[model samples]
Target chain A: MDNQTISPRQFMFLVILFSVGSSILIVPTPLAANAKQDAWISISISVAIGLLLVVLYNHIATLMKGQTFVQATIAVFGNWFGRVLLFFYLSFLYILASLVLRNIGDFMTTQIIPETPLQFTHILFLIVVIWGAYLGLEAIGRSSEMFMPWVVLLVFFFTITLSPQIKMENLQPVLGNGIVPVVDTSTFVIGTPLLEMVTFLMIIPYVKDGKTKKRAWILGTFIGGAILTLITLLCILILGSDLTALNTYPSYKLAQKINIAGFLEGLEIIIAIIWMITIFFKMVVLYYSTTVGIAQFLTMEDHRPLLLPLGMGMVVLSIIAYPDVAYFETFINETWFPFAITHGLIIPLIVWIGLLFKSKKQNKTQQEPS
Target chain B: MWSMISIIVLALGIFLLEFPKLYKKNRKKEAWFFTIFLLSFTIISVLESLEVELPNPLDLIQTFYKMIGF
Candidate 1:
């Protein structure tokens, strides 16, 4: 745990790893299902949604003027109510950890090791998260920093490998059914993976130089968003609209299709490993944030004690939140709209807006009589 | 069964690792809320995972993809 301040580039790399990890592998399959060949609309729409949330988060970050979410919560809302709102934030984080871990667990059983018991993989993932947290923020930061290049490079390779199989014509008719479906799917786009960027605020204050903080976070986010859009387009081009919809891991299938003189067959497993690695980092980041934020918000001296209960809680919640794969993905697509928007969009906006007024009033007073 | 025991034991060990900070005054409600929420969250996720049914969005997705041959 080197207390050395993080450069902006390191944080940006963390964002790239966090953003591309989960969204790249399987996000397009669901988006393709929702948007048809029109899944491109979902990614584009989610991009707007992601950016909108980023703007909200940025506004809150700016209003706090370098305060972490913990410090800002108390400053803007006062001690008690701030704590209440933070509880909600924590709950949202818990749900997020649950969902991501559960998704990872599902993927592991389905793709990585089919015979291994689901519970075993689930618990094993938790062990990594818990152990990782024990090592502290620097560990997560350093690991994300280290692994990001390989993750990004592997993704480009996957996308390029499927380049030939991608039938550009499969994406035709360009909004043929009209704006209604595209916009509807776009909301689905917003609700699913992209809006989760609200968690980035937790990491904002930790940026070593306050000057380049915004640029670093946005760099990470936009880069991640770009990767998502490209993968969605690639999946649509490769799998058409139907089978892409049918398969749970359509992006993996596209990578599998990259056969170079028949020797490159089954390379999508490489992509799946990429998915697993990147998502691992994403979960670690979110889980780490949850523990650290709670510890800080509660005024604890350290966050190490909270990791296990949090991990166990996530596993429990992931199982409880969605009944089956269809419902799991469904919860992600539809039901999560209000849930995500409330936490991801609505609450953050309120906190930021409220804090903005608070700062202005204080600034005005500071200039007046003193 | 053995794995579940390990998870619970590991979780408890992890919780105990932070025992010194648990007594701090500022973090009580937070500790309470987190403990309750985590417990509740886990129970619900485990129970829900056992139940079976497709959410409507998935069916719609499948149908739409099929209609478009996508």
Candidate 2:
């Protein structure tokens, strides 16, 4: 278990999949609602800011080299305070895993399989996630590597087929409402999938090559952000801002618009497939981190034993996490940004500053020649 | 009632599957931790199956942000 490692390529695939995860389905709607025709602009700006955030995360990873997020916190803050912080961080990861589970379950129930119980969808999904985590990171990495091309092919087909429907006039009077709305909409975009990339810190240490890891991290983010931006642009161009904002799953609807000579129609399932694949890897990564974080927290050797129980907890939490879609919407729009910021930005910044101070103290001690 | 029974049975099945592995290895601490987590979650699952009220965790974040005036 200790010797397990994933290649830089596999790491990149996981990052790409994680970035594109739930955002592919839901991001365009809110962006369109707030920024209108300039929603793509909002995402582009957020992607830029998200790049900087990734740089910050990379720096923290370098500073605490070879330590997982849990270990890094404990290393930086000392035992007691670190454990306290770890408690909050662990809960954050756990809640996030549950939320991601809930996201898919909700999507399945409302969009794809309306008659199925949410619990059934959640259980089936958790079984796969739990099994992936049980197999450990190496298997997860290999599987992601195998599945990467399919995700890319599906996304490419979805985009190319929808190209014919894009209306140039939908993006008329660019930034017409001024940059204010675009910037405002970007706040929501930055919180999700962007700040949420901070979770990748847990897996960064396990990537095999030290030199290429940073490159993989940044490139994966860039590609994922580009894919998301393309999808958002298509939604606005084809569906228009009003209709895009109206639909809960705009991209799913966008896929339904695929009509190649009126023969290749109803490829909406392509969107569903792409979303399910990305979200599965995303949840697996999160679930893996949560389980591994707990095992490390408990000073245990392996994380597999905790998988089933934690998964059961996740199923229950996923159901109760959002009473209905309305509350979930409010939470994502109103509350998620700040909550994500606390864990993603503020905590990492604190740890980075702490590392700097510690290193400076070490320099001072070395100069004293005692 | 059926939901409750199924939940309990599922919990027991999970326990049976996992506990023996820890027991065979003589990992007492690991076993204890596993039992605590499983038991707590099982109780929650049963409560959930019964349609009992369970606090949504995200509400904590929402409340915190509200207090901070976000």
Q: Pick the candidate with the highest lDDT.
A: 2
| Deviating ranges (above 4 Å) for candidate 2 | A363-370
- Model 1 / residue B23 / CA error / Å: 9.0
lDDT of 2 by residue, B9-39 (tens): 9989999999998999999999999999999
Off by over 4 Å in 1: A1-4, B1-12, B15-70
Worst 10 residues of 2 chain A by lDDT: A157-166
Q: Write the per-residue lDDT of candidate 2 for residues A1-370, one digit (tens) a residue.
A: 3668999999999999998999987799999999999999999999999999988988888887788878878877888888887787788889888998888888898888999999999999999898898888999999998999999999888878878777999998898999999999999888988888878888998988888999899999999999999999999999899999999999988888888887878889888999999999999999998899989888888888899999989999999998889998999999999999988898888888987787788789999996
Give the best candidate by TM-score. Answer: 2
TM-score to true structure, per model: 0.86, 0.98
Give candidate 2's whole-model lDDT: 0.90
Query: lDDT of each structure?
Result: 0.73, 0.90
